[model samples]
Target: MASTAHRVCMAMLALPAIALAHGEIVVDVGHTLAAPGATSARGRSEFEFNLDLAREVTAALQARGRSARLINEDGLIPSLKARPQAAEGAAFLLSIHHDSVNAFELQPWQWQGQALDYNDDFAGHSLFVSRDNPDTARSILCARIIGARLQRMGFEPTYKNGRRRAYADPMHAVHYYDGLAVLRHATMPAVLFEAGVIKNRDEELLLRDPARIARMADGIATALVACLTAGQPADDEATADGPPLQPVVE
Candidate 1:
């Protein structure tokens, strides 16, 4: 009996891992409660927005009968590298985040008697992928798919921040940002989605709307499913070259 059981276990281990490769889509919630990311115009933490939208996205995916997992749902995952490690076998990793501008761009404002910083110059969504990722091509493909879907749903793409950002797809606002730990450390295809510029007061209000949030979540869910089921684009089809390390004196 022991020999037979050992044989069965060895046979199971020998099975192809193709099914495991097509595992659950990991929706990683950016930042943690203790070290919440960028602060919004209305004093809301970026983590709050990320968690909210991630929840909706996960639910939407499950509704479509797709395997989905939400990482850092409790806002407790502290290490950036650990986030990707948790998604070791995931088909893809989408890190949800709210955007903010540089400190110099922020203008002082009063919200309910409290001083706050905000930037209204840029308003829109942005997508990022890391060239260091093993599946960089697939990462860009998925980013483009999500960006195009968001654009089709009436969400414009932001283009003002060009300092250290490189446009992988200018039309879709997909940037090749190799510095993002979550994207660079991920073994599977990965994308860092900036849902909107929360620092832009006007856009912040729009993104804060529950109905609009639901729509955005739906768009993400649809795009992810399409990317996963669609044919994989040729590796050469996606090019990722990040910006130069030093600024040009000229």
Candidate 2:
């Protein structure tokens, strides 16, 4: 009887990990919060770019054997309230946005002698899990990767001083803290990044380009992959209040 029981225990112990080893990084591109009356063509365009970027990232990841998917549809935000369970067990949730701030003029361009104006909010940031033992390290890793790539690609950083700061090599603030709705409810670590200012003449131009969107997506996918490579679970829930997800960075 002891031997039989031992055999049963061995069989149970041998079961493979059920956690999606080839984890799914869920992309949510319908970032709607601040920028009221942003449902116009321009607003929609900004949102569409995010979708394209995610698709590009997904394709690149597939090429590299990392499984990824977009939970949101083109030009539509998912009804999270309608289906909260899908977020459960996801490796990560990345909500993408194009900052849609009002246009403003820069004096002396602050850093340079050029007159600068940007409609882009440059509100690039991220938020992780708040739950104790919130497994968010992987998502943070993903944010860092995306930030680094965007910085290198000449995406100007809009500092709190309302100035465009030079991208500090190897230390892009692309990753910041927030406790938005998506972050709070998500069972996995999640983030929301303002890809660029879509309202700024230059940024708006870039956002409209397929190549640029593709590059952004590729960067995100690569970063998420890196986080998965690291073997750490989510950290304990943090006590701080993360920024809201609706207003998005920008």
Candidate 3:
């Protein structure tokens, strides 16, 4: 009993050392990270270029001496088709998405053929996750960490200024009981990041810039290492601090 107590004490002392075993970060491009099909409108959704962004971030993380992996977008389809699988062997899962006002386009002539007097109030980017307890809070915090990094990187996002807050009612804000399929079905604590307003023409043009995309990836990677996993620091911290992102012109 005396020897066992000594060993247990040693193990307890080492807990913090192991706290940062920072596992792999699995990212699922909201649409599909793999090759795009003709049936699927490539580069149409906000995530059209997500895979590319993933690659850049993956490389950056590796360069900074972080252990990470990218799950093929194909693997995500099955999970999205239904409830998430068991988190079994993952540290975290991140889903990248882009939203536009296109959802309203599908439901035109609302309110007795009179268009609803609603403005496309939603603008800029947001980092969101589930609202469940403990694990969900941690995931949401991780998303918030990324959001903080984004702000540090000089993207003055307009925040959660959407007209609606519930996914059933709001075109966006889908990350809980009514979240997007991928976010809902993620086996692990997952976050969905709407990088920008793809619907806005000005924001749409910003997406085309490779530099901005790279900055976004770097910001994501930095946030994951600095905040999410507590990975070992390699050198100077590099964030996605680029130019002030322009608002999407209607």
Candidate 2 residue runs with Cα over 4 Å from true position:
1-21, 32-44, 74-84, 102-133, 153-156, 160-170, 174-177, 231-250
Local distance difference test, each candidate: 0.80, 0.50, 0.51
Candidate 3 overall lDDT versus native? 0.51
Clashes of 1: 0
Off by over 4 Å in 3: 1-21, 33-43, 74-76, 79-88, 105-122, 132-134, 166-181, 230-250
Q: Write the per-residue lDDT of candidate 2 for residues 149-242, one digit (tens) a residue.
A: 6667665454532233212122555333333456555666566666665545555666678886777666666666665655343331112222
Error of 2 at 27 (Å): 1.3
Give the alpha carbon lDDT tens digit for every residue of 31-63 in model 3.
Answer: 543423211111353445556666666677777
Question: Best TM-score goes to which candidate?
Answer: 1
lDDT of 2: 0.50
Model 2: residue 15 alpha-carbon error in angstroms = 17
Q: What is the lDDT for 9 in model 2?
A: 44
Residues 106-225 of candidate 1 have per-residue lDDT tens digits of: 999999998998999999988987765665666777788888999999989898645568777888988877777888778777899999999999999998899999999999889888
